[model samples]
Target: MTITENAPAGAATGADGVEHVDVLVIGAGVSGIDAGHHLRERFPDKTFAILEKMPGRGGTWWTHRFPGARSDSDLFTYGYAHKPWRGPSIATSEEITNYLDEVIEEDDLKAAIRYRHEVTAASWSSSDHRWTLDVLRGDTGETVRMTCDFLWMCQGYYNHQDPYRPEWPGMEDFRGVIVHPQTWPEDLDWEGKRVVVIGSGATAATVVPAMAEKAAHVTMLQRTPTFVAAVPKTHELAVQLRALDIPEDWTHEILRRAYIEQFNELTRMCLETPEEARQFLLGEMRPYLPEGYDVEKDFNPGYRPWQQRIAVVPDGDIFTAIKEGRASVVTDTIDTFTETGIRTSSGQELEADIVVSATGFNLSALGDIPFTVDDEPVDVSQAVTWRGIMISGIPNMAYVFGYFRHSWTLRADLVSDLVCRLLAHMEAKGATTVTPTLRPEDADMEIRPWSDPENFNSGYVMRSQHKMFKQGDRAPWTHMHEYAEERHTLPAADLDDGSLQYR
Candidate 1:
């Protein structure tokens, strides 16, 4: 993608007061910002800076302004590991963004942020025992280089590509207004327009009902159906959390443990027997659907539950919208866009005044850092993971890995803790660097799709590091498909047989 106006520019040329830092963090999105805070707390007086590509903070939140944009995960689980979200179960985009802004404000992270600067490339320097980075500030269009002893990749997955628009035959020539939920335009006029939301994942599920509030007609178009689960956005526990008067970091830890346990049990039930899992999920969700609704077409998934992150909404409001006839569903693959509307593979064409391509995000790792191990683009697919935290060949780096089959913030918190723990160990040992390597046997397992293969391009599944590992000893110890497994696998203390080499 060519550079656009949204990109930030470097401030000034001279590094007069720039000096050097113990770490150079990239991107101020959730992962980057959260990691930067942890780094600061763990090692104060060690100067570090967060280099963001945008004019402001909020990585995916800032970039994706789609209609009805909100978090799929409950706010209780979606936020930072160190700072808990105080209100509601699921939060709106605006609310979440506000939460992040507050985190930045309270921490006094503004001074450490170098906004508008995107790291174009970074390489490990053997001689200097640090990493050299080349940055381009979109605002100024100036190139600046930076160096840091340790480079951390916290830029989350959603940064890579624009929302995908399949070249469904004649989509390019469709006469309707086509938009992606990821990059929604605020000025867009969807009022009273006939709208069709494409894809069956969370994005499609989210946009249809939200737009139905104003659009004259709303129709959801799905390639394959996904399992739907509904829970309330407000609960007693949330009220208790807000009233606790506990410190933010302590609150973060308590809620973090609670969610880790909740999601882990569900994962275990699913992996114990796929049938029992499906039955349990169906039992919990089937009653909410309209009378006589077919679970097979509407919710029965061919892939295992949690195989694709299940879509969650508040109290099945989407179904309520459909039941009230404000919205409807169409299960068919899109063939092409016609002059009037979309022609699906089922020989049906749905007319629409505006079409939303909620097709999902692409898998681009390391934010925008295009790496070359030896003058060749490093193929992340071909690389092996060292317990899903660090890649085998990369040195002086630790990739941020989110949760699957569990809460995302749960694993991220663990990764942040481990990074701090490791750094403290290095500090005690008087070491300059530490890199974890995967053992020969540990790297031999066959890789499986972390999410559904059909969802290979969707951001939630694709944009993340995709590899699974066994953890600890005995039956429950193996992390086949539960949050407990991850809880066991990722510990603040040394747990794994890691190859911790120092330079």
Candidate 2:
């Protein structure tokens, strides 16, 4: 897909010197970059631009400058379907950022991006059939107005500013330095100093092995256990194919399909027989642990597999660190923070010179951008998502939210495809707008949480439940994590399903 030099005719310019385009994509992350490429290919005549809040590209990778920062999912599927990732399965933060930069450079997307331009609010105009956005310039305390035919929210779901850190008594009394992984200090020096990492998620798992290389000792303090698994650097089939001199792109595609298929079956197993799935997952980890190790106590989680994200360690680095006496796991609740250490509820005092809280992030949607419809403020919590992309009563707008079970970009790719179809259909019918509205028969349909609470028990998601959009109990209204179901349904979905109202 090549970028066209010309902008579409009759592009709207708002009252406050607004710059308009055919589409306004709100982010320069993976989703934003993916959407840009698809739009260029699907609608070559239309013009669009990406607004990035950060000074650089790579939304999550750029912002998160923590030590041992890397992807929990493999690069093959986590990567865009259009792009081929030639690196190892698990890539570091810097590596991922560089990959994004490569995409931006090769695809000529840099010209279409405006860094440090944060979109503050977006209001839909019914009369003009457009969206007027209020964007704040990062360098200056000024607002830049913009108008668009459609708004694409490629911003991922997570709060960047404030991460979730629970208050503990005597935290002020702790003499050791406290750090959160989200805001890791650049000049931090922990060499030969005792370190305590809190939480049991992927962040904690990654940091422990990484910091153990320099720190005197690293202790992973967790209130509850999480499912941790080891993944190889490359798929066996890809490795075999490469050995036989198969082309890189072809090998990557083979591996990508294999991973997707494996995960799709795993997702089905989780939904169908959760207990069996949990046992199978634990069984995979048993061989990595020391003899007589309590897999149930340390490796097993309370919830079923895929409910919360499963943590993946590249080549079992964390386990190696523990086995070699460089790191250890302490399963207990923190009673209080003492001057030089933390006291546990079990009356154990763990000495530490530095404490890192890998607690979790605050979940936010549309980059927390305020939205309005026809000059009226839109309450996202009351809105229902149409196939996890378009929201009910929202005109010519779509948000790219990925699958929680599989690699995020898998669903993003599908959403981008559907969006292109929607835009093309609108053009063919001479329609200026398309909005998913609840039908009369759907008035009494039971409204539930966006995801089933039992199947999604992540602390960050549960805490921010009130802020997320709701979903219906039926088809086209539910947000599914199953890639197989979405892969087949979304691309062939009926445009005139009595939900999407066009004008």
Candidate 3:
């Protein structure tokens, strides 16, 4: 089988216009950019294009520009394997966007990006061995059609257009400003205002400290406490490596590996020793709080450490704000919204002039793009995911999903590498398509949740679990959240493991 460009003669134009490519990458996020880079480097002969819904590059970083918006994960792990992060460990939205722009310029991927092309629907044709995508062009309301041999869903799993906001009783009665962090008003004045931030997650953790700096007093109102840790703003290992006359790329690689291994160990500890891990984490929080403060009531979460994402604060900013009396935390249920503030279930009335709902995201899968396989609408909830990349019966398609336990890009790099390898395998076989074909014996196997029912109880995961594909009880069918397990198993995974069928 020799690799060469092949366009089917049956390919025809749709009502608006039609374009064909070897690979169609959806969204211009970090995952999409990595897919583009991998395709260019590994399969130069194959034609591909990236479709981004936003007006420009940087999907999450571009859209989320709220006050104190930064990554919960460190930069070394979040940054791509090909690109070394030169900024601080935890990067702000602007810094991240700038890094993405630099990556686009450095790799010269701007030409292949079709900005404002939002994919609304995708249909797979088994007979044609291609995917037809209906894309909505932002400039014009017209829907354009794009056909590709392989469909890569690089859009990160979450609905960026809408965030989750619970309806509160008497919320309308409040006379002050109410803002959700997702769509923060750019010109809104926050200075010297009594601010109340709802929720106790990453968004709330960042917003409380950030608003505390400018506002008269900021109060974080939470139903439950979330585990928060302090990570250094700068990479100490990178600095030490650089001081040792190590090359920039080498230094980055060393620090990246170190962080990955460390996180992997941490995840293991959380799973194997929940009691000890919980106690240790709470102990870490003790020093950051003021004297006589209640650690168990204020810092301890209902769940174990790694059950949900651990929010990282740079230099203990949030703790520092609380210690200095600039910010405060209230752990109680909201009874109702008063005219000037919120009333708690404990009969506590907190006065606030501004309300910031730092509530979590409305999780989404495949960007709500309606999918059809051979004219039959595909239901993702009914299907099983294969290796966290491809759905069991989805032919010639892959999506990027990151690890819940560690850095997102760690799994992303592995997925991209596997995809490039699989593409090469298909080219070697002279095949146009490959799908994860389930065996007859495997069909009767008991289906399990995408994650362990007991271990995976994150609020977002629980809310969106029904929309996501399931996982089987065995290998290749189960998605591994552990980086150490994936690092060893994924590279060595056999394409001919009786699961993948090629044509």
Candidate 4:
């Protein structure tokens, strides 16, 4: 199974020239770093390189620079399974990036990564049994060619260049500066200014309280309420473990399991008893707000708990800001942008010097890279996901799409193991490629959305559903399972199953 250093013996080369490897992993974020570690550990004889479009590592963490940008999920599970997170459960972007830096350094993955290589187009040739990639170097204006036997897509699920911002009437008439959290300006100042944050998602929840500290006043304007819960920055048990002089790795493993069990129970409760779960969430939120605040008006969501995602505020910081009169919440649709502020449908004028649009982002399928199989373009929407890792009709390629309800890295780590196992299986079978194909018996299986709207319908997912791959109603083709289910199913999944065609 040993592969040559730069050029595999059987791989093809382009006319100009091309570099070839056994595996080419896309992105240098959490998932890519994990993939690097697995490849080095399990298959030292194989040659692979990681490609990243940005100038540095940390895909999402590096891209998001807005005020108060942090992880909404607890770091215990969000952190890589092999690494120990010693910081607070909810960490800032800088802290997360530093953690990634340590992982890259400790695992000797820095030399295997190319910082400015961006894959623009990929074409697969069945005869050659290889993939030729067209990569544009961000550092230079030139495009380079490369080839690989296997492609691992870990570029993330969202479009980092553009964010979703709704068009409101009279936007041109407004004189205030409008900013989107995705592209937060470096020189913009909000101190001593009237600030208004639009939308009630995680971004808005993080920005409002952070800006309220210095802004003359801040208003969180939302069309509808979102379920919000307050969580401690540091887990109580983690502190106790440190007090006992327990080893860091021991503490990490114990807390990781504890958090996973706790979240699994919460998710199950939300699914089985919607009313009770909703009541419990609301009850938890009530103690954080002012004694007589109208929780029903500003905090109660139209949907049940975990319908989309519950925004987590560290130490009830957002509520504390509201209780101190530094910030306020107004739930109403925008009528139009006034000369200096925004006007609500209720005829109330909310004046502001600056506005932050914390609307969601756009989903990118396979990093929006154009693909061709033997000169035929690939429309990803028409295909079905195979075990939520490989797509039907796509050969020698597997992608990392994480869970929406849980920490993304949970699924990322699981998929890494599955991909490594599949690679080993292929090598043992002496196969050049493997593709997911629908059997004749599966012809009549119902095709459903990638994620069922009933289970979790976030705005970004619903807005981009038509562009995502489809899922079948049968085994090995469906992926709407929870982390607890996937943790077991993915590892024990039969690689010899008929759904995967080996050549």
Candidate maximizing TM-score: 4
The positional error of residue 259 in candidate 1, measured at the CA in angstroms, is 3.7
User: lDDT of all predictions, in order shown?
Assistant: 0.70, 0.88, 0.86, 0.91
Q: What total of clashing residue pairs does each candidate reach?
A: 10, 0, 0, 0
| Candidate 3, poorest ten consecutive residues by summed lDDT | 1-10
Q: What is the C-alpha RMSD of each candidate to the true structure, in Å?
A: 5.5, 2.6, 3.3, 2.3
> What is candidate 3's lDDT per residue for 1-503, written digit by digit as tens?
22222322223344445678788899898899989889878877777888999997877877787789999888888998899888788889888888888888886677788889999999999998999999999989889788899999889976888888889999999999999888888998989999999999989999999999999999999999988888788878877877788887887788888888778777888999988988988888889999889989978988878888888899889999999999999999999999999999999999999999988888788888899999999898899988899998889999999877687888888999999999999999999989997887697777887667587787778888788889998878888558888888889889988899999
Stretches off by above 4 angstroms in model 1 are 1-19, 239-258, 372-379, 438-482, 492-498
**How should the candidates be ordered by TM-score, best one leading?**
4, 2, 3, 1
Candidate 2 has which clashing residue pairs, if any? none
Which residue runs of candidate 2 sit more than 4 Å off their true CA positions?
A: 1-16
TM per candidate comes to 0.86, 0.96, 0.96, 0.97
**Candidate 2 lDDT over residue span 362-445, tens digit each:** 998778889999889999899998989999989999999887878999988999999999999999989999999998888888
Model 3 ranges off by over 4 Å:
1-17
TM-score for predicted model 2 compared with the true structure: 0.96
Where in model 4 is the C-alpha error above 4 Å?
A: 1-16
Instruction: Give the Cα RMSD of candidate 1.
Output: 5.5
Per-residue C-alpha lDDT of model 4 across residues 1-503, encoded as one tens digit per residue:
23334332333444546778889999998889889888888888787889999899999998999989999999999998999999898999999999999999898788788888999999999999989999998888899888899999999987989899899999999999999999999998999999999999999999999999999999999999998989999999999999999998888889899989988999999999988998898899888888988998998888878989989999988999999999999999999999999999999999999999998899999999998988999999999999899999999999998888899999999999999999999999999999999998899999989888888888998999999999999989999689999999999999987899999
Sort the predicted structures by lDDT, highest score first: 4, 2, 3, 1
Among the numbered candidates, top lDDT falls to 4
